[model samples]
Target: MTLPDGGQSPDALRSGTGGGSWDGERSGRGLSEREPFDLLVTGGRVIDPASGRDEIAAVGIRAGSIAYVGPVPDRAAAYSRRTIDATGQVVAPGFIDLHSHAQTISGGRLQALDGVTTALELEGGALPVADHYRYAEDQGRVINFGMSASWSSARMCVLDQAPAVRPQDDPRFRLPLAMFDQFQNGPRWQSAADDAQESKIVGLVERQIAAGAIGIGVLQGYAPGSRLSEQHLLGRLAEQVGQPLFVHARSMAPAGPGNAVDAAHELIDTAELTGAHVHLCHLNSTSGRRADRVTTDWATAQRSGLRLTAEAYPFHAGSTVIGAAFLDPEVLARDGISTRSVIYLATGERVADADRLLELRETDPGALCILETFDLDDPQQLALLLTAVTFGDAAIASDAMPLTYTGPAPRSGTDHSERALAALTGDVWPLPDGLIAHLRTSGCFARALRWLVRDLGVLDLVEVIRRCTILPATILAAAAPAMQRKGRLSVGADADLTIFDPDRVQPAGDYTRLAPSIGFSHVIVAGTPVVDGGDLVPDAFPGRAIRGSAG
Candidate 1:
C-alpha cells in the first residue's frame, strides 16, 4: 500500500524544483496573489471523479468555496491562513450518504470520522420537514444534514389520528426514528388507506415538499399492506414536482407479490406508469441473497432509460427496529433468514427460536436489532452481497441507524421509548457509556474503501470515489441545485472535502464493539474543518441546510 512517490517526504518532492523551505513561505509562480485562502491542503493525490483528475495537487479554500486547485510551491501554507499537510493521503470530495438516519450531534461526529460531510435521511425521512430542519438548525449539526418527506409519517398522521406536530419540548416530535415507537403498532402500519385518507396523505406530502423537503421518502416495507394505488398516486405527485421518491421496497418474502423481485417491479412499474424518478434505498439488505439477480434487472432497466438509481453499503448485516414487517417468522423463513440470525441490541443476544423473536417483537417492537442477512465468511455468499455494491453507477450509502443507550436496567415498553428519545436529543459528545449502534454509523465509508478497493480489488480508487461523491450529488442536484456545487474539486465548488490515508483507512469496529474510524486526516464542510488532524473539532458547526427548490 505504498503511496505515490514511494512514501517520500513532502520536502523531498518539493526539492525536485529547488523550492523554498517546508515552512511554506515561498509562493509558486503559477499561484495568484490577490488574497490569502482561508485554508489550504497540499501534497495529496487529488481525485475528482466528476472531472478525471487523479494526480498530486493542492487545494485552496476561500469564503466556504474552492478557490484554487493546482500545483503548489514547497511552501504550500503561503497560500492560506491555515494549512493541512495532506501528503501521502487521498483528497477527494467528501462522501455523501443518501440513507443515513443518524441525525444527532454525536452521530454526525462519528460519521465525520468516516469521511462523510453530508448525511441525509432519505429512506425514513421526517413528517414535518420544516420542523426537522428547524430543530437541526437550532442544535447546530456538525455535518450537513437534510431529509425527505416521509410517506410513513404522513400515513400515520392521517390513519392513526396522530398529531402532525407535537410541542417543542417533545424531542421525539422531530426525530423520525421515534415513529417506530410512538406509532409502531398504529392502524396505519397494517391498514390500507381509503380514498379520502389517501387524498389527505397526498396533501400532507405535498405540503412537506412546499416546506422544503428534498424529495419523498417511501418506507413501503413497513406498511406492506399499503395498496398499489397509493404508490401510484405518490409517484404521480413526485413526477409532477420533479422530485425523486426514495423508496424502501416491500418485504423480501420468497414468494407471492411481496417477494423481492416483485417489490423491485413495484417501483419500476410505478416509474413507467407515472414517469417519476425513483431511488431505491439499501438494495443490498433488501435484496438479501438475490442481490445479483436484482442488480442485473436494475442494470437492464437503467439501459432502457427509466429514471432509476440505487445505493448499497459494504456490510452483510442490517440494522432496524424489531417489529419491521419483513422480520416476521413466515417472511424470514421464506427468505432464508433464521431466527438465530437476529441479535437483540439491548442484551446482545441472538434470538434462539421463533418464540423468542415473537416475544421480543411483541414486548419491545421499537427496540433496535441486528440481522445478519449474508454470511460474509462464505465466499459464495460474500460475492452475492457484493453484487449490488459493485453494480454500475450505484452510490455507496450508509443506512446508519440512530444511536441509543441501554442503561443497566434495560427496561422495555415505555421505559425503552424514554431511553431512545433521550439518546436522540442528547448534546453530550464522546458519547456517554452504554450507547450502542450498528458499526455502519461510524465505519461504512472506511469499510467500503478497505474491502472493495484495497482488500478485494473489486473497484479502483477513482471509480469508488465516483460512487461516493459525484453520483449522489448528481442524483439530487436536479432537485437541490446547491448539490451542483458539491462532489467536485474544481474551483468555485463547495470546499467540503475529505483527506485520508488510503493505506491505513479501515473500519475500527466489529459486531461486538463500536468505535469511530481512524486514518482520516481531515474532513471539511463548507471550508470549516470539522475533523482536523484525525480529531473532531468540538465546537465546529459549519453544517447548513440543503433544501429543494419547491419551497
Candidate 2:
C-alpha cells in the first residue's frame, strides 16, 4: 500500500494533509508548551481504520485519550513521560471482540496478549447486568468489558429458576459456561413460555437493560421451544429501547426446523417487521455450507434499509454443550453429522457412537464438545467463507471461551488483586490440562491476520483492521455511544492500541495445546500499558465498563 503522498517517508506522510485531522499548533514549539504526554509511540505505521489513515506517524497519549497524531518534530520528543520506538510495527486500534465469552481474569490476560483490548459477551449475554458488572469490577478486569442481557437467562428467571451468576468465591469465574449449560439442559430450555411467563421474561429484559446492558442477547438454537412470536416480541422490545438484538440463530442444519437458510430468514423477517438492528452471531457455524446465500440475503436486507449485520469466527469447528436441543438425535441426523464427529473437550476423545453421545448428554450435559462441521482445514473453503464475510461487511469475532484456573485464595486484598500479583510474579497458574482446549479462544485475530493478509493475501492490513476494529465499534456505538471513542486512532479517541510486527504475527496453538499468539510487541488500554515489551503488566486493570445508552 502506497502512502497518500508521492513518498513513503515518515516526514512526507505525517506532514502531508491526508485523512487525519492534524494539529498544526501541536506540531512544533507548541508541543513543548503543552502538558507532557503519558506515552509516546514513534516511528510506527499507524493505521486508523475510521479515518482511512495508514502511514508512518507518531501518536501521543495523555490521560487515557489520544492527544496527538502526526509527524514527530524534534522538540516534541521532550514532552513525554515514556517513548516507545515502534519501528517495523503496525500500530492500530486494539481489537474489540463482540462475541467473546472470555470474561475471566486469565481469559483477559490471554486476550490482552493476543492484542484484544475490549471483549464483550453479545451472544448468550449475562443476566442481571448490574451483578455481572459488579462482579467484574470487584474481581478486577485486565481489559474493557461489557455484556448484553441474555433472553435465555431471563427465560430461566421467569420459569422460577436461579439465573446463572458466577459465585463470588469461585476462582474460575465461568458463569458464562454455566449459563450455556442452563440453556442446554434445564427444563426451561425446552419449555415454551405461556402468556404470563412471556410477560415476565420481557419485564426481566427491560430491568436488565435499565441496569446497563449493552443490548439484548437471544440464543434461539438452545431454546427450540420458544415460539417465533416470542422472538418477535424480543425484537420489538429491542426496537423500543433503540438497542441491537444479538442472536445465535435457531439452527445450522441443512434441513428441517434447524435449516440455516430458514433461520436467516426468520431473523431477517424479525428485523424487518420490528425495525430492530439484528446481529447474527457465528455465521460460519450457523449457516454452514449455505453461508454464501445467507450473506447475499443479508446484503439484500441491508439495501432494503433493514438494520442487519453478522459476525464470523475464523475456525471451522464449533463448540457447544452436549445436551443442547439442536443436538437431539433427530436434529443431528438432519444435519447429517453423527456422534463420530464430536470431540470431547475435557478428555480430547471423540464420541464413538450414538449410544455414547446419548450417554454423555444424559450424564454430563454441561461438558463442552466440539463438532467438526466446516472442514476449516481445507484452505479453499476457509478462504471462500472469509471472502463472504468480508464482502458481506461482517465483523470478525473470536467467540472465545472462558479459561479455568485452580489455586489458593488470594493472600490479601481482592481476588483481582491476587491474580494481578500472580501475573506479575509469574506465579499465575493455568488449569492442569489448560484453561480452554481450542486455539480460537486465544488466537482468533492473529490467525485471521496471518491467513487472510500474510498467507492467502486476500485482504490488506487496513481492511482486516477495519473489520476487527471500526466495523464492530460502529455496530455497537449505534446503541452505546461510549463505544464511539474506541476502535479509532483519531485525536481525542481512547488510547487503546495494539502494536505488532506484521511480518511475524501468527497464531501458535491448535486443538491439542491452546496457546497465546506471538508478535504482539505492546498493547495499551486506556493509555496504560497492559502488555509492555511483549509482557503483561502485572496487576494492571485499566478496563472500565461499557454500558448502553439506556443505562
**Whose lDDT is greatest here?**
1
Model 2 residue 286 CA deviation (Å) reads 0.4
Q: How accurate is candidate 1 locally (lDDT)?
A: 0.83
| TM-score of decoy 2 | 0.89
Compared with the true structure, all predictions reach lDDT values of: 0.83, 0.78
- Flag clash pairs in model 1: 24-75
Question: Runs in model 1 with CA error above 4 Å?
Answer: 1-30, 409-423
Q: Which stretches of candidate 2 lie over 4 Å from their true place?
A: 1-22, 25-29, 163-166, 169-174, 377-384, 404-433
Error of 2 at 469 (Å): 0.7
RMSD of 1: 7.0
lDDT string, candidate 2, 94-164, tens digits:
89999888777777888888899999988988876787788888777888999998888888767747655
| Alpha-carbon RMSD, each predicted model | 7.0, 5.8
